[model samples]
Target: MSRRVLIKTLPLHTNYGGIVQAYALQRAIRDLGHRAVVDTGDPISLRRRVLHRAWAVRRAVRMLLPARVDWDWRASREVLAPQQSFVRRHLSRASAVERADTRRGRARLARRFDTFVVGSDQVWRAAYAEIPEQFLEVIEEFHGPRPRRVSYAASFGRDDIDEYSEAERARATELIRRFDAVSVREESGIGICADAFGVHAERHLDPTMLLTPGHYRGLVARARTDPTPAAGRTLVYRLDATDDMLRAERAIAERVGAPAMELLPTASPGSYGEYAADRARFDRPSVERWLASIASADFVVTDSYHGCVFSILFNRPFVVHANARRGAARFDSLLGVFGLEHHRAGASADGIDDRVFTPDWSHVNRVLEAERARATAYLVENL
Candidate 1:
């Protein structure tokens, strides 16, 4: 019997890692003979919301920019205000509406399935949340008593329970205990949940790593582009901004005599077209094209989680930059799983002198196969 599975998360909205992981998981779930759909836990159409958000972001950025051209109080305050109580509350309410919208959206998507798999990103981040009650209520309504509640690759990221007050920790623990099966995307997360939430959960790889590069080779092949290797320079790049990390990438490229290519964010005509702009970079006679372009890259330097995950999958040497963002500490734990601690990036590129490439695909592949089997079984048995 085909299982109806509703997968939930705050869709990548703009991040490449988020999109790839969500799509990979959706594909993997579908391969299990189940119907799986990604619901960003919000009903708001991101495409429609982009213009308003872009304008808001522009306003915030402009207000925050210093008059003297320095990153001073006025500029910092504008950027910092979003973290204030009033702004947080307003954002939370906006999110609640979005979640309610997601619930309404799910009603149409939920009709075809039986199980709901929730996760693969920082869906529990407080900044992105309205209220716990509002969040939990939506979860229960759609994935209530009947369908098995499986947290495929959920993460709390850097927000440790210990950091919260005793009451908040207890409350979170109670909420976490409700899940039927919980799996985190990093080993450190397992410890966090076990010690903090008082629940033992398995740690799994990002969905992108679950399938081999060959599985996605066809997609890359279709988007093949003329090789753009810079004589001796290799491609060094990142998703978001990181001066030190980008510097490190340049250092590596120079040391190896390779030019670096950085992939930047592209505007989506619609949410579904997030990868549409990138489509040109990977086009081929028969392949999806974008995949091919990424595969052809000599090396990758990125701070994005999905970047590291895909780099490993494609056998590309790369560096993973740590995010200084408040809730993104999970990167450390994720890299630890692959024994790639050396690849971690911080504020300064201090230690890594001239190491060119270090990746253990053999061990990574074995672990991936084992976890994929377990994840696949969990879906099949529950469905």
Candidate 2:
């Protein structure tokens, strides 16, 4: 029998991984013969909306008012426009739930589905600790039939649960105990659930990993009727771009005798003014183009987790720069799973050239196949 599954995660965020993970999970669920939808409607108060705009204004001022302006507002828009479009066309259709902030609102939302899922990202992180009642979907004193609650690959962002206060922690533990089934993205997250909440959460692969490379290839190919063939060029996708990382990318491009292409942020433009302008004007690539960029790259250098994920999926040689700001546990756990620990690059360019080598696909594919099955099985049994 087909069941309706509603997934609640941090999908409204602009991050590529966050968006893609939501899409992947929904797709995976549907592939298992169930109807899956993402709860993209998170009720934001007027005050929060005003604060968000203020934050954007501040960031824009900082990026634009610099002495030698390193970021371009228009260029950022060009990069993000397609990504936003992709979400609208591909993801928004499944988003039927309305914004629910109050108990009444949540109950109305809950009545729409049979099962509610929280996660595949840092939905349980400390920053969201205060809203555990909503984001975690554990409402109190409702007379209506309760939906089965579960978490798939939910992460805490960090290894420990120190972000929550003592009171908050106690409340969170109580809420967690209410989940019918729980799973985490990282192995350390499993420990966190056990020690912090006394909950035995299973570890599962990221949703992006749940889908095969062919699934992505088909999506990208459909978006681009006239696909750009691989030209053995170096693709640089940096979420947290740094001077050292840029230098390494340039050096690698020089060594390979191919131009270095970058996937810059739509919110924070980089210092490459002319390149940014050119991309904004002529080569405004959408999410499809972004995927194609990674698919056709001869080599890739990136700090983003999804960036590294696509590189591996396409079987491209790549180097991952450590992005500690986003938390290293995610990268460490993922790399360790695929046995690609040596792919991590240092801040310096030392031995970087030597680090670029084809991965052992025979081993990596085997691991991915097994892990994918396990992840699918967990969802099948739970949902």
Name the top lDDT candidate: 2
Candidate 1 overall lDDT versus native: 0.58
For residues 149-189, write the lDDT of model 1, one tens digit per residue. 67777766664644455655566677678767787776667
Candidate 2 per-residue lDDT over residues 294-364, each given as its tens digit: 88888888998888888887788888996877767877888889889888888766676464665788888
Off by over 4 Å in 1: 43-112, 129-136, 139-145, 159-171, 223-233, 265-293, 326-328, 345-350, 353-358
The TM-score leader among the candidates is: 2
Error of 1 at 78 (Å): 27
Give stretches of model 2 more than 4 Å off: 43-79, 92-98, 128-135, 255-257, 265-284, 353-356
As a whole number from 0 to 100, the lDDT of residue 62 in candidate 2 is: 74
Worst 10 residues of 1 by lDDT: 85-94
TM-score of 1: 0.69
